[model samples]
Target: MIQRLLFAGLLSGLVVALFAFSFARVYAEPTIERAISLEEGGAHKHAAVEKGTISRSTQRNAGLFTGVAAYCTALGGFLAIGMAFLHGRLSVRPRSAVWTLALTGYVALVLVPQLKYPASPPGVGSAETIGVRTELYFVMILASAVCMAASVWIAFRIRRRMGMALSLAIATGLLVALAAVLMTIMPAVSETPRDFPRGLLFEFRLHAALMQLIVWGGLGFLFGRVAEHVVEHDRPAGVVRHRIPNA
Candidate 1:
């Protein structure tokens, strides 16, 4: 069962790579190029190529595809494991379970942390502070994941007594309050240069967010279908076997 799920996940990853790569190539690559150009100040156009380093063209093409493929592949494996654990626990259809997990994952892993430490293009922040920035960003993700898990547990625990709607409401309120407190307490990080083009920054971040949406949304949709098929196929023989009519 785990092997089948893993295969499904890897397959989904490969399928999603095509869409993600195309979107990034069309929407994100230009913004990245502009940022790189700004970083170089129009100089060193050929320095990297001449120095035997990978050129921007290669990075944006084959490199981009490879990186996306790798990321999605690993994500798919994790998603499969999550599905295995959550399969019957959610009391929902397989498709619903997969999508719910994906949505919650995106919020906890990406959206929450991003709100605190939004992604910056190359050359936006000081290299000296990168370690600190990375540590803080991961801390935010960890905190957000913990809050999400707690909320889910609370909702499940009280749903029978308080009712699903009210339990969910309470859990949501708790999550929001915890998120707000974390945001307020975490140290702020502003690394964009004063002279940086605001419009470019906005566009870059927008593209980044859209790319993530594509990755998560695509995975959910694809894996949901696969999971549905797997569940139908794997039904216990007793459930499907015809009983002799009191012979």
Candidate 2:
């Protein structure tokens, strides 16, 4: 099962990386170039960047591929573990589980934090605050995941009493309210310049979100199909029994 899931994840990650590389190359890369231009005294003379050892060609080509692959590979591995855990826990069908997880992961990890800290064009944030910003972003992701897990737990706990529909509705509402409150309390990072082109910023962020949507959506649908195949061929009774390999 682990082997199968690993194979599926790698395959899905590869496909996602291709799409991501294209999206970045077509939409995000130009914005980045503009940011680099700004840093080189086009718009923001004070924000000049020190030259790095890595060549631009490498950054645009090999670097992008490597980064996207590594990221999607890790995400695929995580999703595999999640699928294993969720195998028998929910009443959802195996395919539905994949779709559910895909949507949930995207919402919890990307959308929620993005609302609090939207993606910025290049040269928007400070070099000194990079560490701080990265930390905050991860913290928000962790919080969002925790909130989602809590919501799921709450729904399951109250299902026997409140019924599935009501329990889920209540839990969903609670999670939304909790996330909203967190977003409000978290310190805002406004790094984009006041004079920055609003249309360009919107385009950049829109493409960023679209790229994420493609990755997660592809993973969910692809993995779900693969998992369904595994269940049919590998399992003895054609049932999802949560059998972990060598556990």
Candidate 3:
């Protein structure tokens, strides 16, 4: 069963990676090129190409696909393990359980952290502060995940008495409160160059968030379908007991 789930996850990841790669190649790549140009002080494209060992064409093509494929495939494997552990425990159908987990995972790991520290394109932040920025971002994700887990546990404990709707509302409120506190307490990091084009920065950040949305949403939708089939196939057959009259 674990092997099958892992296989399903890997397949879904590969499928989504294609769509993500296409989107990146078309939309994100141009933005990246422009950012590089800006970083190079509007130097000729060839200058930027000469600076890096890898050409822009290669970076946007094979390099891009390889990175996306590997990330999505690993995410898929984790998603499958989550599904396996959470399958019957949620008291919901397999599809709903899978999607719920995906959505919550995105919120905890991606959305909340991004809210605090939005993604920056190349040439935005200084090389010196990259380590500090990375450490802070990781801390934010960990805090968000812990908060989400705690809220879920609280909801589950009270769900039977409070009903699903109220339980969920309470959990959501707790998540929000915790996130708000964390965001307030965490030190802010503003590293974007003062002269950077605001419009370009916005576009790049928007694309980055959308790309993540595509990956998570696609994984949930595709994996949900596979999980349904797996659950039904593994379900035990119903047994009918016959009463025998005393002989």
Candidate 4:
């Protein structure tokens, strides 16, 4: 099952890479180019130099695809492991699981931390604080992951007593409160240049968010289908079943 999931994950990574790359090329790339142009046009502009060993063509093509694919592959593996732990427990069907995985992934991985440390264009942040920014971002990621897990456990426990709907509601409220508190307490990073185009910044962040939605949602649905097929085939022969039931 793990082996099959790994293969499924790699395939999903390809799917993510295709969509994400397309979106980046069309929407994000223009904004990025605009930012770079501004950087070069300003007083900080440097003299034009010879092309580096790794050409822009390669960076836009091979580098972009390879990086996204590799990251998605690893993400898929982690997602698969997480699902495995919840497989027999959750009452989720394979199709619903798609949303579950995608929503949880986006919330815990992207949305939560993004509220604190949003993505920036190339020239927005200072070079000197790159390391500090990176460290804080990752720390937020870790905190969000932990909080998500705890929320799930709390919801599960409450479900046993308060019932599913109410339990989920309570858990969600708690999670939101915790996340809000964290956002307030976490070190802030306000690095975007004052002169940067607000329109371009919004577009860049919007497209970036959409890319993640596509990657995670696409990967979840694909992996869920693959997992369902595997589960059906693996079920006992003597057991009576109808069309690989949800959950």
Point out where model 2 deviates above 4 Å: 237-247
The TM-scores, one per candidate, come to: 0.90, 0.90, 0.91, 0.89
What lDDT would candidate 2 get against the real structure?
0.81
User: lDDT by residue for model 3 over 1-247, one digit each (tens)?
Assistant: 7778889999999999999999888898899989887777743222222287888789999999999999899989999999899765666777887799889999999999999999988777776678899999999999999999999999988887888899899999999999999999998999776778789899999999999999999999998899788877776789432332212
CA error at residue 211 for candidate 3, angstroms: 0.6
The residue pairs found clashing in candidate 3 are none
TM value for model 1: 0.90
TM-score of candidate 2 to 2 decimals: 0.90
What is the Å distance of residue 141 in model 1 from its true position? 1.0
Higher TM-score: candidate 1 or 4?
1
lDDT of 4 by residue, 1-247 (tens): 6666567667776777788888778777888777666766772222232235987678777888888888788777776776666666567665566558768878988999998898887667776788899999999999998888889889877786788788889989988988998899999998776777789889888878888888888788777787777666767889865443221
lDDT of 1: 0.84
lDDT of 1 at 67: 98
Which candidate achieves the best lDDT against the true structure? Answer: 3
- Off-target runs (Cα >4 Å) in candidate 1 are 42-52, 237-247
